[model samples]
Target: MREDTAQEQGLDLEPPVPMEEEKEVMEEMEVEIEDPLPCLSETDTQGIIKGRDLFGYVGIEAVLDQMRRKTMKAGFEFNIMVVGQSGLGKSTLVNTLFKSKVSRKSCTPNYEEKISKTVHLQSVSHIIEEKGVKMKLTVIDTPGFGDQINNENCWEPIVKYVNEQYEKYLKEELNVNRKRRIPDSRVHCCVYFLPATGHWLRPIDVEFMRRLGKIVSIVPVIAKADTLTLEERLEFKQRIRQDLQANGIRVYPQKEYDEDAEDRILNDKIRENIPFAVVGTDKEHQVNGNKVLGRKTKWGIIEVENVAHCEFAHLRDLLIRSHLQDLKDVTHNIHYETYRVKRLNESNANGLALSPLTLENGTLEKSEAESHL
Candidate 1:
């Protein structure tokens, strides 16, 4: 009688539900939500994640911002080496490259204080900050190169230095406990200054670039290009390329290493204008009421920054603007990989670790490195 009275008062003992509605309520509770980027699936054989339409904000695009923040905080290191004969305006060009006094003038008498009896290696570093990003730029200058009367085997010291860097990196990597980021002192790029002789590649230049090309990224440039006529510059560049091809010298942006069609298209343009005819001057000259870094010649100012006047812009673009990171990549991937593999294979083959150096004339020199095949 009390249950009947409660039911009559509009309170049901059990809330009644329709069969179809009850089944839908149970099904909704049992359903499991899935991720859009499914890692594995019965339908996907190769396990590739295909792009899908996002229903809501997933924050995936924030990864680029995170990477940018980390890189900005860490800054960057770029080490470049300059190799050329004396008085080729190497320092001037390097300074022009950074748009600051990063490189000492080769003309300065203090620089020649030590008459380079042999090819000696030295480095200078500067911290350049641009728009909150700091770049530690180190310029390794090779003086006394080809300065001696007998310039035979002048590249020995440079080779030794490069190998020494590789050895340093290898040792760091082999350490049981290593630094979070090993200091990258390896030569990223070697800008070889070729004299504007309006001629083919010289034997010394060829030899230097060929050997260095294997170990480092080489960017050969015709220095003091203003000295040559426009016609002469074009002919000289053509001849240099021909000689380089005939001699089997590998320069930067090697066709074999092109990453994809985009890289090939961009690098093809650079290859067509290899051995850039470049002039470097840190002097600011008045051109059309504006001061430009250029040389004040009788035939107007040879604007260093002006592409119309010289190809320095092209060289700078390739070096710093367009291919700076690419050069570093090539060094780490191709050049460093070659050195690393050779060293490891030799160590394994010999059944012992090779010493860093062997004595020659009571002076320590780099052990024989495998031929860069």
Candidate 2:
């Protein structure tokens, strides 16, 4: 058996290899190979370096300009009020803009299983100026209309507060304790938050906004925007723009408008009645002993719940660019010029010391304010 096996297990039998196989082996061995060079050429390497440099320069310039502005502008505070319907996520928006997560802490009761602790959120109206802009931003988050159990008819009370306080501030001189009082001559703006997913404008929203418009520049904030389909959201925005325009209410212009936007607006019936979404705690459940139903899912809490993502950012940007910008310009003028002239005139009328500049015919002499500043 050892002799018979073709050079058996350990034996070498090497005589009958085919010529074709040998030729194939030789050809494979003869194949040429090329070595790889660097992946990037000189030109490409330079381009990458140039782009990085350019980006660095732009970033550096932005930081420097911000620093310069901070140094030059003192903390100029402007008070703003935010009002909206209950459950429209006004609290969420406030928490987002101020980056404080105040609402989350307040809402922790809903998540807690231990001992069933309840956390009620307080009404917050705090200053949130960007550190660079320091004390410039003072945001007032007002409680929603009809939110309190006892204060169901709260409109008159809020209006009274606004009007009375504004008048008093205008009359009084700047005192240490009264610094919170912004003068009537001050430029103040209001932000009115609404659900972006629902009908363009509810009757209550419009009526309240119209009244607010008379008082200050009111921005119609489209709140809780993430839950809406893209087309529905765009249509909603267009409807709002058209309605506000028709009502003689000024809205900010968009970057671009589709020519067919007008046609789309006329077709949508935004005026159709919608049921109110009652949002409240169980303790405040029955006002006057009547249970209030919550918002329906079709156009309900989900729409308002997503507000943390969309509405707050949009509202923040709109306020900063439109209302806050105007407020800053006006505040600067008042602090530097208008207040000086008005105070001097009032003092002189009260038989106080006369300054170098004379006052005549209810107006200060030329360059009086500039000289005083």
Indicate which candidate wins on TM-score. Answer: 1
Query: Residues 292-361, candidate 1, lDDT per residue (tens digit)?
Result: 8988878778888887778889888998899999998998898989988877776687576544341121
Error of 1 at 109 (Å): 9.8
RMSD, one per candidate, in order: 9.2, 23.7
Candidate 2: tens digits of C-alpha lDDT, residues 155-193? 443443444333344445444456643544333655577
lDDT of each: 0.83, 0.47
Candidate 2: where are CA atoms >4 Å away?
1-74, 101-132, 144-154, 173-187, 251-314, 321-323, 328-373
Candidate 1: give the clashing pairs.
none
In order of appearance, the predictions have TM-scores of: 0.83, 0.45
